[model samples]
Target: MTDTSSKPILILGGTGKTGRRLAERLTAKDVPVRIGSRSGSPRFDWEVPATWGLAMQGVGAIYISYYPDIAVPGAAETVGAFARLAVANGVTRLVLLSGRGETEAQRAEEMVKASGADWTILRCAWFSQNFSEGFLVESLLGGEVALPVGNVGEPFIDADDIADAAFVALTEPGHVGQLYELTGPRLLSFADAVAEIAKAAGRDIRYIKVSHDEFAAAMAAHELPPEITWLLNELFTEVLDGRNEALTDGVQRVLGRAPKDFSAYANETAATGIWSN
Candidate 1:
């Protein structure tokens, strides 16, 4: 049997939330990795097809984490083309980080499946890191997290746990052809999530439920890019409409243990003082 770990694994969006954590785990195991990012050495850019080939050279596997998000328009085609390219370049193993309750996400999964490569799909719920490391970070620092959704629960998984799962799929065998619906052990509303963060940070952060129009106005006031504005709107209006509220045992199935709870994520993140101004 070939030592797959000895070959380089190209991690797209390698500097991102889950990708970076996954890279750390792979490096700890002495597995070689090539960061597939615009800023990486080979400069892998989804917009530039030329860069993709260079980055995939000699790579045995790939972790595809699309930029901005995979739920955006044309994302399926983009990811499909990338997967096809990886296969054509003689790299067959692939792992994808996807969002739960997303149409485009599932479409991209089908594209990867059709690529004729060994694939593992991790359809994930919201990331607990969003409050500390993502768009909500600003809202947390600003003392308020206002959105359009109300009472809709989301099972937010920890990124570290996600990294661990990806590490297993990439280095260990028997993960191909599997689709893991990764989520935390419990569900929490956006307000509930904020309250947990507040408790951990020992600060008074408020989460207010607003109308979709109000949320759009706030995004406009912040001057976020048009695509980002669109993504946020779609997530709040369509996807979060009680579709992915149910919890899953995906993390346990993949890693042989329960996924981290959101409260635990809050407590650990608070100690890092990222929530502290």
Candidate 2:
């Protein structure tokens, strides 16, 4: 009932996990979609400001999923300026994918709130896909995953649920001016998560818990891009230190069901052979 029949919906990061899912869902429902990626026609690149006007042309709503994360350097400024542009170009609604416990992400959220557009914020914890779809994939394939996080259990969220929440926020009416802190129904430590993957995949995977120093050193040795390495270090050493242990009902509150558990995600993704040899 939100009357989007008149404007194209721009999905930033439309090729990434959440954005891709969101675009699919919207298109399935016959909502108009414009994928905002460097490769798309009328391309959208966060690093390039000029491309934004083309992406925003005829867009009435936006799903802003910043790559590398809103916590990365310059993300807030870039998202802030983009929001201003969207409002200037007649974008009336925005739903931003933000990181939980990230001050930089919060700064970007503030920008959206002040953009004078109707908005919803989905503040997400570390994703369960980190193992199946994200940085954990290479380490799992290599037989060992290492991180600074130890006993701190993160309530890992599903990108599917994040996408669902985003869809509702973008298409529904009451979600305006709300912030949903989305997490799974239960908490699991990194070791437990790895073990769950192993159980699901029928493989022996090892999770190596190291001191923050050792983890950073190993990341440097791997020659990861400096920014990505720094983000990994900061997220593990700073954000994963028991700051987000408790579970929330945001998923249920938003979508009328509990979030999918890590066990469920592990089993489903394993069935797809993503974790298999």
Which portions of model 1 miss their true places by more than 4 Å? 1-5
Q: Tell me the tens digit of each residue's lDDT in model 2 across 1-277.
A: 2457877788998988899999998999888989999987898888889999988898778999997778887889889999999888877688889999888999999999998978889999888988877888988877788888888989999999999998888787799888999999888999999999999999999998898889878887889998899789789877888888989888998999999999999999999998888
Residues 40-118, candidate 1, lDDT per residue (tens digit)? 9889999998888899998889999998899998999999999999899888889999999899999999999999989
Instruction: Give per-model CA RMSD.
Output: 1.0, 1.1
Give the Cα error of residue 5 in candidate 1, in Å.
Answer: 4.3
TM-score of 1: 0.98
